[model samples]
Target: MIDGLKRPACALPVLLVGLAAVGTAWADGIPWADRLHAFGKASKLVCFLPLFVHFQNSSRTRLVFAAYLLSNLLLLLLSFVVFCSPDISILIGAKSPGVPLKNYLDQTQGFAFIAVICVALAIEAIRHQQRGQAIAFAAIAVAFFANLAFVNIARTAFIYLPVMLALVTIRSVRGWPSLAVLVAVCVLVVGAWGVSPNLQFKMARLLGEVDAYETNTMVIGGLETGGAERLEFWRKSVGAIRSAPIVGHGTGSTKELFANEAAGQTGIRAKIVDNPHNQTLAVAIQWGAIGCIVLYAMWGAHLLLFTEGLSRRKGSLLAWIGLLAVAQNIVSSLLNSHLFDFYQGWLYVIAVAIVGGQLQRRRDTDQS
Candidate 1:
């Protein structure tokens, strides 16, 4: 309430989050499915949805968002700069027994989250023309880049880059020149991405096992031995969606359904990995087409708001940043489990809420 974000339409986000909370709460016959990670996510969204509207002014909205943004950046800065993770005990020299030290910050999903935020900040800096901020963000960008390419070597990390570039293009002035410059920058990104050691390893393994599959082979062989198992999971998920195309199999049923479908399939790891690692398919498997629609509806609403802000062109730079953040998550979901991923989902909700809040504020400004 302190920041001056006032809009009755703000109820939309809260309503959707609440609906999601109810859906997860009552979706499964099993107990505590709602209370588990998904419900925990819903609860957090319910709590956070109002904060955006609470901040009424652009300056204050930016301040609140910046505080959280800085913390994410700082966590990334520390994660790479230090040899050991923060708040962990040393195992050898300073052996404290119970508190063992680990280099990984497990709360944040590796490198994907931090990289997009850094990219968003960099864009913000350039748009606003804060030279010092731009230079500092550029420095920090390396840490994110290194973490993505070297330490994490995540595919989603690679996917997020293009999504961000697309988002920036939304507000491009001198459009052709910006497009040309972006194309040149992409050349360097692709070069670095190609050379990443982890990527080379994954590509090699995937190619080695490709011959095992037939003309229409969803069943990839040598899964337990080590190969691209994600394809199988994705295929099975698609099959499951076909089974219950409209309503879906229901929430929290991905593992059960996937395991059943892939059962006795040759060379596959006969396991019920809780998540299929693909957000859309996972939803399609669990909730079917209807569930998929609702899931997308949540984002569709947010996109409308973000685009609204961009069109308004008043204090909408944040909207551009928010759009990029949401876009990164959407793309990440296509390649990773992101629907209820605690950390990433929160970021998504927060971005949408802030942008929506700004739109509400902007509406008032326009009305006056």
Candidate 2:
């Protein structure tokens, strides 16, 4: 394990995180109070320390797996219920009708993953001739997909879900069967778009927002839409990165960067933001080109590791789960800084650590 830490890919994320803390503490211009606040948040990285341990016991691993899956299923059911009933939604005080916990983006991302997992599990159950279990899993997957299509879903979910579906189809079937599944997925998407006004509205809004941003007509009815503001933030963040393409402004410097950029500006251009909403830009703002390299290297390493883990027959489901998490993070990070977000970050960490540990244990046993 210690030897593994010496590997560049394995070591860089940890090293960069430490650097982030130090950079935060020593960042100039930012008040000591603000710097200390950032440092404290950085120090909370210890919360994930327990992930270093492997769940070597099969029973315990099964329990953890069941808990994870069931919790997601529960969330799916609750969200669906709320989506269908405005009164219950209001009673629960859900800011978003379907999302009882967390915001829409996080919940939708989670559901997308769960939908994929349920599909994979269903395939496995069918392969094993467990018809009842297969039926249940497939039904749950349908519910998840329906919620994503008819209820509130993050815009990023539309981008990644198709990729995930393609991966799953390729993994589970091949040749004509694979082609058929892909076609079916496309038809389902088109059908949902036609039948679900919610999907149509969201898609239309996304297109309008992009057009508005490009045309510099962001303010409609005297208020700025979030989509245009996000685009403006990305534009400014790119300029900031170009200004300091090497070491960056320092950790916790994004707020200050945006503050400076917003100075003497007007409208959306004047809006100050802490998160540029893009993960690469977010990291590059703090650590620059080096940070981007380390960030991508870590993603590439985990992705490759999980891809290899798929060849291990004993626990390939875990590998699939890990792969989905990593791939989702990579795709979604293009639009949102999910890696820095508490729930999404922990999800990524837990999926990688648990699956990687199991694969390592299996490799050791095979070697012996």
Top model number, lDDT? 2
lDDT per residue (tens digit) for residues 1-368 in model 1 = 52322332344445545554555543455345523544454456564456565544554766765677577566555445442453442323322212122223222343455555566567678878988887777676676666555544434554666767666654554568778767877887778759877557545655765553433233444333223466667777777778778766555666666667757865544545657778778667655676566667656766666776776666577677667767777877876766466667666766666666666777788899
Candidate 1 error regions (>4 Å): 1-48, 56-59, 81-129, 194-227, 262-267
Go through the candidates in order and give each one's C-alpha lDDT.
0.59, 0.77
Residue pairs that clash (backbone atoms under 3 angstroms), model 1:
3-55, 3-56, 4-55, 4-56, 5-55, 5-56, 248-287, 248-288
Task: List TM-scores for all candidates, in order.
Answer: 0.75, 0.92
Listed per model in order, the count of residue pairs whose N, CA or C atoms clash below 3 Å is 8, 0
Highest TM-score: give the candidate number.
Answer: 2
TM-score of 1: 0.75
User: Candidate 2 residues 1-368, lDDT tens each?
Assistant: 45557544345557657767767743668766666654444443333324534443233665776788799889988998898889999998998868998798878877888789899999999999999999999998898888888888888887888888888898899999899989998997998899998799777777777777766665765545668878998988999899878877778888888898889976677888778988999888877897788788878877887888788897687788778878888998888888777777777777666666666667778888
